[model samples]
Target: MDSSSVCHAEHVPSCHAEQKRSIHTGWRADVWTASSLFLAKISLRPRIEVALSTLACMRVPVAFLLVLALPICKSFYCYISETLSTACMPVVVFVAPLCNAAALASLEALAKQPDISLGVISHFPQEQLPLHIRLRLAAHWQTASALNTAELLYAAEKMHTYFGKIDVLLSTNEHVQEALALIREKFGIAGMRPDVAHNFRDKARMKQRFFEHQIPCARFQRLTSRQAAYDFVEQVGFPIILKPLCGAGSVSTFFVDSYAQLEPALAQLNPSEWNVALAEEFISGAEHSLETVMHHGRAVWQSVSRYLPNALDVMQNAWIQWRIIVPNAAEQVAYSDIRHAGQAALSCLGLETGISHLEWFRRPDARFAISEVGARPPGAQILTLHSRAFDCNLYEEWIRLMVYDQFSVPTQRYACGVAFLRAQGYGVIKHITGLDEVMRECSALITDVQPPKLHATPTGTYEGDGFIIVRHEETAKVEQALEYIINTVRVTLG
Candidate 1:
């Protein structure tokens, strides 16, 4: 086929236009040679052939390299795209693993197209893969899997064998350092490097940093022994927060209101394993979080969210409910100062070029102080909600920033907010009410409403029982709708 025909056949409109332009400019011969080399492999693979062809038409060198490498090395690309696609829609996935697998399987089926080649592979053990391929795969997997797991070690060794230019590694979990080292040796990306992730994961160390930085935070001390904890209370007084240093999702987080409650609280923990706990002066106020994208020592995009009734209190109650508010324009001025302070704190901590979730408290006087900063996306599907409200794909933005050092600036077209619905009392969930009505009534302003399914009881208050994320061109409408939903909807349990 002629180059134009080939471009059209490959569904690369841009390529055809460019080819026509080049021909008119007397560069037809050179253009044809390049196009031929690019399309040489289009006939080789059917499943990803289209993706490959699209990449070829765009003349993306990395795509070409990956295409060439695919045949020589057994590699699988897992697309979590479906997760984002179906997230905002009204759908209940009772089984998370099943949903993930089905999504991957459907993507695999789609890969059967003439333009696509690679297929989705299940998360199988290393032993199932070819011995040669197993080595590199092991290294990448070690970052996600437990080090003690056999698969992790296998992956680490495999990673070391392939890409060896890495130098530094960062992990919050102490159990994964050895795997990090192995992967560093294998791929040479960099040896394990000390980072704030370690300190953030270790509650005691995190508090120490805050103290050293003179960052406003609760008065706190860490203890490993029961006697020490008791002594700490004697010195600092009662009613403190206690939790594991490296745990997520508020797991095992408890509040000791008095010395009388300390022992029972301690009983719930394994001092030998849980080891460390923080005794801190509890600050009473509204809790809010600043989500930021920092680059080159500056915060580029920042979002401020106020937790309804507060997350700490919600976690402490463990049986009550909570929601979150993304302030409208009128409240922006008040929160902007907090966002600036958060950005400054992140800058001081040497956090640059990544997404950060910083929790803060706004005291009665309107003063703000940092609670903690995590070097990852905020939990509770917040990213999805933000994307829905702003018409921006944060994950995609993050990927671009990480890979290409570029991000899209969001057009502030509408104000968006999410309010989480939580169980009123502990028991099996009888039902979730008001989602249909909320969607129908606020259809003009509400972008998405995802309520917990019937029988989907929550195990903890912080489990994100359900959420309603909305976007409105006018800030007043957004606020009114949010108030209406909060006042009307109820998550009842038997």
Candidate 2:
């Protein structure tokens, strides 16, 4: 791919054909590589004058001049913004994991907005990201971790003079939503108010809000003391699930099959880690997630997906594996009940605009009960599948919602699914078996694949060590291929 195509592939803005001609593909490298370097060391008057003269002498289009001379323009823009205070661009504070190449590419769609200055607040440093992604970020501030909101806020404050005012706070990962909301309030910025943040962050409070709206969900109790948990179990019976009042990724979540099971789980939990604990009556049913994109208090796009064996079970039992299926035809029709519940949950949350990852269950009687909702995009390559299935860049559209308050592309053209491969036994990964069989059998149906590395230790997430995404026009075909993959692929550790 050419430089312009590479830009679009990274979700960056592309130069027009006329602009491309000015650079003249073969001639660009040697000239601009030298020009951009010399462009940086020069000063204001001489910089623009020489840049214009060089471009005019070469008959380069002005837009191509901006592309080749991006560094010059950037330094110039910063000079004006910092010195003359003449910059009118809105400054947006973005927080998300920066390690993944795909995530970085998607995020670049926002960071490279020409008229806007993006202040990236991340747990990972620029060194952690690829050079292509690192170069795109206008300003970067690293934190000790995602929880270090104070560090992020202070950095933003220090950058205000240089970048004007931080207008909006945004995060693609749900873990940072509450922090983003708090930061927005602290800085007098706009978007996703702190008051509205609770409906997603605090799962116990979220269930209460949903229940208040007459939305069907499992019975839950917010508990502080051990006695309260026991009392909840007495009333609601055994087989309860205990989790942090505010948590993500089913981390530290416990499943209690009986009083015997409850005691050991209770003894292991340290209440100090989480401010509050949640004990809820566990419901037996199939699990599904309602993916919705909201704009101005209304859902403009929605999709339904089912999980294999459920996340909680997958976490509890090391042997259990899982996959997510974005349903086709009849499954989508059957998921209409969940779609209704998810819409109601968002309406009750009262969030003006954002993405919702709402996990709900369908009981044996066909009753739909909400599990939890996160005010962010679903993880585990769900967005990747959504993009392939819909023939749109879901990540780019998601960033648009965070930056522009709307989803530019709005249609689904296919169905998609992902099967996560994990080690059945725990230890350092020693070998992977049945890979060639699965890949060769499923190659045509698979869009992406990453086999587990030979010696890396396993990450104890639902995603496991590696995963393969399969997509097709028919959801049934996708489902069939996923089942085939999960059954055949094996990661063995010793």
Candidate 3:
């Protein structure tokens, strides 16, 4: 045997002896580990006392043992408490300013949830938010000079500086879903990816996917020039829908029915206003929109609403009173194809966990054709109407969807409808002619009503001035109440 292999204590070197002693000491932590570890928790005082009591119960020698472990328990306690303090609180960033009713309501709803905080990164200032709503914003909000991608990223970095780092990004604004998606990808955060958002934000691309999937969607053409518009007219004929490729609502949308009306509608398209415009063969049908909350690339809940006069008609005629009703009934046999096509459309878009506001057509033959899908919450007070109709806090649901990646709320309970008050002509609001009459006739059925404000600016965006919401178990009653509210109320602009 060599000297290195010797096991005799007398023959062992000083360094080897100390190594052997350390091994013995490490192995001897038997009782200390069992009692001290069990009791040495974040609750130091009580844990130490209980651990000491446990050792006493075990009948171990304990006088110096408790004293030795007191400091160790203090260190472990600090570690655990520190971790618990910072680990649970998540940081959220909102893309849009909390100035509008929708943004404000969503913020308030998010505040009520546990273990989350929000920091705003937007083009608007904090003062833009109403005082009450501004008070709820987390840490603080940092405004970017522009809503462009570069400035947005810088503002987000500023937000990160203030709130630690972004854990969730709430993409609530229209026409900027692509920007939000890019930011999410660059930062390697949890949110809508760029590819998925492209399919939503880009209309031509979206329609192309729908067509390829054998999903029933109206044929569309991207308008590059006057020649392209004319070519589309000659090829697809008149009665086509002309709208901004990436716009929401009906801001600059035009419905060209006759051959003579095509150029005037094309004249509405300004290269400065929009980079691209699309003209599609308009499907003649009853226009309705479906609101879906998706999770893990699957739709978890869906709500269908019928658009009064359709959005195209609403845009064409300013006097049209727009109302969307969410019927209480689920699984309508007529809408089966619509639902199936909507699902296929969304799957192609790769909506993993977000809300989709899809508008489709039910033709005279009852066939379905998707008009468009917006990868955002439904605007025009539809969310609030859904809340009243279904008896679920949809604003709360928005927060839960964006922050928690969850859609556990019930989306349908009662049939709900909203009649929007829009200006018949361009001017400031002078007066709202009917309220008492609406209440007298539909008081029991009315859930919410905000009369138009005086001197308010009006642009044709579907949601103009104010709206009245009503709900009931009966869908026909809800429709009747909407008809009453629209016919009864008149917004005067001078």
lDDT against true structure, model 2: 0.73
User: Total clashes, candidate 3?
Assistant: 0
lDDT for 72 in candidate 3 is 84
Clashing pairs for model 3 are: none
Q: Write the per-residue lDDT of candidate 2 for residues 1-494, one digit (tens) a residue.
A: 23221121123222343222111111222333355568577776976688789879999888886687789779768754553432465667677644553456556677456555565666554456565555455555545565666655655565554355787677766666777788788778877877789778888888899888999988998877777788998898888999888888788899997888887777666443345688888989998888898888888888888888888988887766678988764557777777777888898987778887888888998888889888877777887777777777777787777776667755677788998988867679998888899889888888888789988998767788899998887988998999888888889988
Regions of model 3 farther than 4 Å from truth: 1-87, 142-146, 270-274, 330-333, 409-411, 424-427
Which 10-residue span in candidate 1 carries the lowest summed lDDT?
A: 89-98
Q: What is the C-alpha lDDT of each candidate?
A: 0.55, 0.73, 0.73
- Per-candidate TM-score against the hidden true structure: 0.65, 0.81, 0.79
What lDDT score is found at residue 81 in candidate 1? 37
The TM-score obtained by model 1 is: 0.65
Clashing pairs in 2: none
lDDT of candidate 2 at residue 1, scale 0 to 100: 27
Which segments of model 1 are wrong by more than 4 Å?
1-153, 159-186, 190-192, 272-274, 423-430, 457-461, 473-476, 491-494
Candidate 3 structure quality by residue, lDDT tens digits, 1-494 = 22112122112123442222210111112323344457655576887689879988988776678777789889778766644664467877776743677777777786677566556655444556555545445544334333577767766665665455788887567766787788788777797888988888788899998888988889998877767778888888878878888877767887888978887877878433346888889799999898888888887777788888888777767788788888876534456667777777899888888888998888998788888899888887877877787687887887887787676757466888899988766678877787779988898998887888888877556777788899888888988999988898998888
In the order shown, the candidates' Cα RMSDs to the true structure are 15.0, 9.7, 15.3
